[model samples]
Target: MKIYLLYTGGTVGSVGKPLGPLAGPRFVDAFRANVETIITSQLPGTTINYDYFTPTLDSTNMQPADWVRIAQKVLSNYKKNDAFLVLHGTDTMAWTSSALSFLLPGISKPLFVTGSQLPLFFEQDESYTLLFNTDALRNVLGAIQFMTFAIPEVALYFADTLYRGNRVIKSNAREFTAFSSSNYPALGRYGVLPVLNERLVRPAPSTNALNNHIQKVAADLNIIMENINRSSVIQFLLFPAYYDRTSGDSLIVSMLTQLSRVNPPLRGIVFESFGEGNIPDFASMQALLMDLSTSGIILVDCTQVYAGDVNYGAYATGAWLKGAGVISGYDMTPVAALAKLVIQLARDPSSPKDEIQKAMSTDLAGEMVIL
Candidate 1:
C-alpha cells in the first residue's frame, strides 16, 4: 500500500536542547534513514512518499492560510495515494484536523493527524539518532497501522487511541496521552494489535459522490481564500465581572463593543460561557450583545465545562443569550467552534446571521451532537 506523509513540523521532528524544529528536507532525510527502515522491514511493499511546508512553522504559529494550503495539497494528491498521514504539532492539531473535515467532506480514504510531546530523534555528538523511549515513533507507527483499516474520516491518533479529529482536545501538556475526546468514543485503540470500532467509522462515499464533493470543496476553497484576509473571528472566555459601581460601565461590555468597532468588524465570536452556556446578566452586557447580534455578528454560545453539552434554554441565565440571537454549540470543543465559525465566515462573508447560526448548530462533520 502507498501512503503520503506530510511532515508539517511539530515536536515530533525537533532536536537540540532547546527543542527547535528541523528543516523540512533535513527531517525527511532523517525519517527515511531511521523510521523508514523499520517500517519497510516490518511491513514490506509499503511505499512512503514525502512532502512538507517550506520553512516549517511551530503549531502555535499556524494560521488559516496554512490550513488552506494543507487542504489544497492533500486534495490535489488525493487520487494517487491510498491514505494520508500528517505529522502535526499537538498544540493546534485539533483545529487543523477539524478544519480539514469541513474542507474535505466525504473523504473516502484514511487521513490521520498525530504528533508527540517529545522529539523522535535526539542529537548526539552533532548527529541525529532515534529516540526509542519517546512516544513520537509509537504514535506515528500506530497511525500507519490504523491507515490500513481505511477509516473514511479525518482522525487524530495519539498515544494508544484514535479519535474523531473535531471531537478531540489537548487535555494534557506533559503526558504522552495529551489528547482526549470527552463526548465521542475512540475510533480505534492500539494494544498488542490495532483494533477498530468499525461501527463508528464513516462509510466510504461512492466514486461519483466523492468526485462531486471534491469539486464543491475546490470551489468553496476559492471563496474562502478570497475572503480569508477580511475574516475576523474570535473566542471570548467569560469571567466574573460587574458594572463599575462609580462609572456604571462594564469591562465586558466595553471590550466587546470596542471589538465590534474594529476595521474588519468582528464578524463572529464563540463565547466560552459558564455552566450550560450561562452568562452574567449585567444589563449593559446584555444590551451590547443584543446590539452586536442585530448588527449581523454571528454569536455562538459554547460551554466552558469540559464534558457537557450547551443547553441555552435549560437555565434563565442562558435564555437571554439565546433570545439575543446566540446559537448553541452543542458539545463542541472551543477549538472546533472557533474553526467552524472562521471557515463559515470565510466561505461566505455575506451569509446572513441566521444562516451562520444554523451552520454552527448543525453537525457538518461530527464535531457536535445535534441532540
Candidate 2:
C-alpha cells in the first residue's frame, strides 16, 4: 500500500523549542529516519513518503491560510496516492481536520490526521524505531492499517479512538488521550486491528469515466478559496446574566456595530448561546438579532453546552432567536462551526445568506449532530 504523508508541523514535527531543558534535534528528521527504518524492517512492501512543509507551523499559531495550503497539498498528491496521512499538531489538529472535511468532497479513500500528546521520541521503550512513543506509534500504525481500507472520511485518529474529524474537540491539553467525540460515538477504535464502525462512515463517492469526482471537488475549492475572505467571519459568545446586567445591550450591539463597519462587512457570525441555545428574551437582544438578519449577516446559534444539540425552538428564551432568523447550530462544536463557516463563506455561492444557513444546519462535512 502507498501512503503520502503531509507533515504540516506540530509537536509531531518539533523537538522542543530552544531552552535549558528543551533543545534537541528537529523532529521531522528523526521521525523520517524512524519511519523509513520501520517500513524497511517491520512492514516490508509497504511504501510511505512524506513532505515536510518549509518553516513548519505550530498549531497554536495556525490560520485559515495554513488550512488552504494543506488542501492544495492534498489535491496535488491525490491522483498519485492510495491514501493520505497528515501529521498535525494536537492544538489545532481538530480544526485542521474539520476544515479539510469541508474542502475535500466526494472522496473514496481514507484520510487520517493524527498527532500525539508526547513527542514521538519520548517513548520509554528504547529498542523500537517507530514504537518509541507508544501512543504516537499506535495512532500512526493504526492509521496505516486504515489506509489499506475504504474508509472515506476525514478522521482524527487520536489516543485509541477514531472520531469523525468535524465531530471531535480537544478535550484535554495535558493527557495522552486528548480528544473526544462528546455528541457522537467514535467511528471506531484501534486495537489488534483498526475496527471500523461501518455505520459511521460516509458513503464512498461514485466515479465513472465521465466523472472524476475528486478532481471536480478540488477545482471547486480552488475557485472558492480564491474568492473567500477569511477575515470577515465573526464569532461571539453570550455571557452570563451578569454580562446583561452590566450592559448587555451595549455590549452585543457594539460588537455587531463594529463588525458592520468592517471593510467588506461581516460575512457570518456563530453566536454561542447558553444551555440549549437559550438567551435572554430582552427586547434589545431580540432587536440586535433582527438587525443582523436585516443586515444580511448569517447568524448561526450554537450552544455553549459541552455535549448536546441546540434546539432554539424548544424553549421560549430560544424561540425569539429562531424567529429572528438565526440558524440552529445543532450539535456542532464551536471550533467546527467556525471552520465550517470559513469554508462555506469562502465558496461565496449565490444567495449567500441562505446558503450559509443551509450549510450550517446541513451536514456538508459531518461536522454536527443534526438529529
Query: Estimated TM-score per prediction?
Result: 0.96, 0.88
lDDT of each: 0.86, 0.75
lDDT (tens digit, per residue) of candidate 1 on 1-371: 79889989989998886787888888998899889988877778999989998878789889987888888878877888989999998889999998888778778888899999999998777578999999999999999999888878999999999999889889999889899888889999999999999998777777634445666778878888788779588889998876764465987887888788777668988999999999877677777788888988888988878889888668888888877878889899888998888898998888887788888989888898887
Q: Please estimate how well model 2 matches the true structure, expressed as its whole-model Cα lDDT.
A: 0.75
Which numbered prediction scores highest in lDDT against the true structure? 1
**Tens digit of lDDT per residue, candidate 2, span 1-371?**
67888877676544434301112234445666676666546556777767766667677878876788887788788878878889888988988898888888766677889987765654333222344644677677777766666588888888878889888889898878899888889988877777888987877767621127656766777866686664477678888543353455556666667777786557778878889988777767787778878877788888877788787658899878878988889899877898888778777645568767887889876777666
Colliding pairs, model 2:
123-132
